[model samples]
Target: MTNVYLTARFPRIAFTKLETNGFTVDYYTGRDLISHSKLLRKVAKADFLITTLSTVVDSEIIDAAPNLKLIANFGAGFNNIDTEYAKSKGILVTNTPKVSTNSVCELTIGLMLALSHREVEGDQMMRKDGFPGWSPLYFLGHEIAGKELGIVGLGNIGSELAVKANALGMKASYFKPHQLSEDEEKAQNVTYKPFDELVKTSDFISINAPLTDENHHQFNAEVFDNMKDSAFLINVGRGPIVDEAALLKALKANKIAGAALDVYENEPVFDKKFTKLKNVILTPHIGNATVEARDAMAEIVADNVIWSSKGKEPKYVVNK
Candidate 1:
């Protein structure tokens, strides 16, 4: 029987599935994976390891797990995992992709609506009994209907956002490494534009690109300067894609109307300065955090463990 170690709490469905297959599973929850050195010591003997973004699986950690056959990530982004080091040791790494697309896309739209309408601010004011009477300019916000929306990437989440934006009477334009086909363009009603042009012409900009070496700090002072003064920015993608310092400056200087972010450069540890700004809406990286998405991701991780244990191909192998 294979022994599996879960570095963080996952959906119970995964544990039940693995147990049904005669695998011994042990997990620790409600503890910080980074700060807990004893947990990694226990992980050293496990045959399969299931992890979340909170945990780091580097060369030293992988070396500790000599019996490890697989490392299954319970989310789409495996940026936390050291894939090169894992592959060098012939350890299979897998991630759950496309499962959380709709949930994340929905959150992106939610952030856009909330930021544009000042939803959070309004809610807080109402709760504090500060809503005296309706005034002509009471919480006046940017209009979303028939506005130009620029998407940084046109992948699953970005494309879904495009569809939703179109339905809300917005024109969709995207900038990606590759161009979309004519059929795809017509279906989503997305026009491919140059990055610079998209930044300059858009009334609202939403970033859905992945974090890569080329895309790191993709949004900086120059890009913010090109945006319209009334433009709003929303990022549902990786944190490091936008330079944190540049974003703070842009928001403070009113270079753009406002910004909404679900991820940050140093996630789970936000910049102290961001809390002081009222123009920005921040979420604790809950893009793919829906209950359904979490369960689906857990099932994917379980499938990877089962498949790898049986010498079969996993559904979403990252190392391969």
Candidate 2:
């Protein structure tokens, strides 16, 4: 039997299909994510390795797995894995994309509304202490309608956000490495702007870009200083895209109005300072936590492993 090692917990429904393909699949049975030491030992003899954003597939891990032929990532972003190193070792890498677009977009807009309306703060105060009755000026929040929204990435999730933002009476604009064609922009009802222009003008800035070497820490102290003091920042993208320390400084200084984030600079162990702030809304990277999306992700990753195991190319190869 071909040895296949999975570094994280996944849906068994998908694993059954891989099991039928004549591979002995193994995964972490612990309540928490598997540790790197444990993962190193498990993947030592793996023919195929299934990875997650939490797992770091560095050069050391790649070199240890002499039988490893493929690294099938569970999410759209593969930055966690060292693709360059993997390719140099003649291993294929694939990611499950498009399946979580709707799920992530919904979370992005939800965060926008949450930050604009101070939804989490209101709920927390209500649950912790009894209401002191109604007042003329109580629980005030910024209105979402008639606001300008700037999207940082115009990919699948960002484009969908624009469509939803327009329906909600917000002016949607975007800045991406690649600009859309005139016809595409007209259909989406989005205006293109330079990155600086987008930051300075938007009432709410949403980041939906992937983490890349060029744009890592894309939103820093300098970027925050350029933003409007009343603007809200929302990031449903990778954590490293925003500098955690800079974000903490901005929040403490009230440089921006407020911020909502689903991903953190150091994931699963984000800065403890974020919890003390009243103007921020933090989530545990649940941008694509919906059941439907996860099941589809499981199916896609399983398909990648199955196809590649048979010497056929997977559907979503990133390096090729």
Candidate 3:
């Protein structure tokens, strides 16, 4: 029988799909991450391995799975899996792309609004200090309308964000290595700006790029220094894209007005100082945590595994 091993407990929809197709599925059900030794043991017997973004499938894990046919990642991002190495060993690697685009884009917009309007701080104040009476000058947060939103990636989520931002009365600009053509830009209602210019001018700068060898620590100390003093930073992308230490310094020094983040440089572990800052709002990487998005991703993962089982090439294969 074809066997599937999941590194973590995901939605039961995937297990149902796999079992209904006559595949035996097993997964780690612990709240914490699966231990490396247990992962090696389970993967050694798996024909198809389903991994989440938090599970690291390095060369050692790949090598241990002598019968491994596919690594179907449950998330849109596949940085946790070593695609090149998997391909070299004749193991197919796939990710559920576009499944989380709208969810993450919406979260990005939410973070932007929450940070700019001081929603988190206000909520805390209401709970701790009680209502100080409604006054025009009570919160004094900035409005997002008529503001410029600069996105640092023009992929699916970024493009979606641009469209949403324009609808919300915010002018959206983007910076990517490959600028979109004039027609494409017109279609999306976004203007292309150089990275430096976007950072220096926009009221809110969002990081929506994937993590790559060239883009680790893409936003560092210098980038923070270049941003407007009143600008806000929002990151719904991979955590390592920004230098967390530098961000801590900038927030403390008031280099920028504030920041809202869904990811951190070292995930599951971040600077405790950020928790104390009223200007910063942090989430536990819940960009795609919506029920609809997670269910869709689960279906995608099961579909990819089913395709591989039937000797068919999956549509979402990432490594050729």
lDDT of 1 by residue, 207-231 (tens): 8987788999999999999999989
- When 2 and 3 are scored with TM-score, the better candidate is 3
The per-prediction CA RMSD against the true structure, in angstroms, equals 1.5, 1.3, 0.9
What TM-score, over all chains together, does every model reach? 0.96, 0.96, 0.98
lDDT of 2 at 167: 91
Roughly what TM-score does model 3 have, to 2 decimal places? Answer: 0.98
Top lDDT prediction, candidate number? 3
Show where candidate 3 strays beyond 4 Å.
none
What is residue 312's positional error in candidate 1, in angstroms?
1.1
Give one clash count per candidate, in the order shown: 0, 0, 0
C-alpha lDDT score of every prediction, in listed order? 0.88, 0.89, 0.92
Error of 2 at 275 (Å): 0.9
Once fitted onto the true fold, the runs of candidate 1 whose alpha carbons sit more than 4 angstroms away are 34-36
Candidate 2 residue-wise lDDT, 1-320, digit = tens: 78888887888766887888877899878877877788888888899998887788888898889999999998999988899999998999999889999999888888888888888988899999957989979888888899999999998899999999999999999999989999999999999999999999999999999988889999999999999999999989888899989988998998999999898887888888889998999898898898999999998888888888888999888976
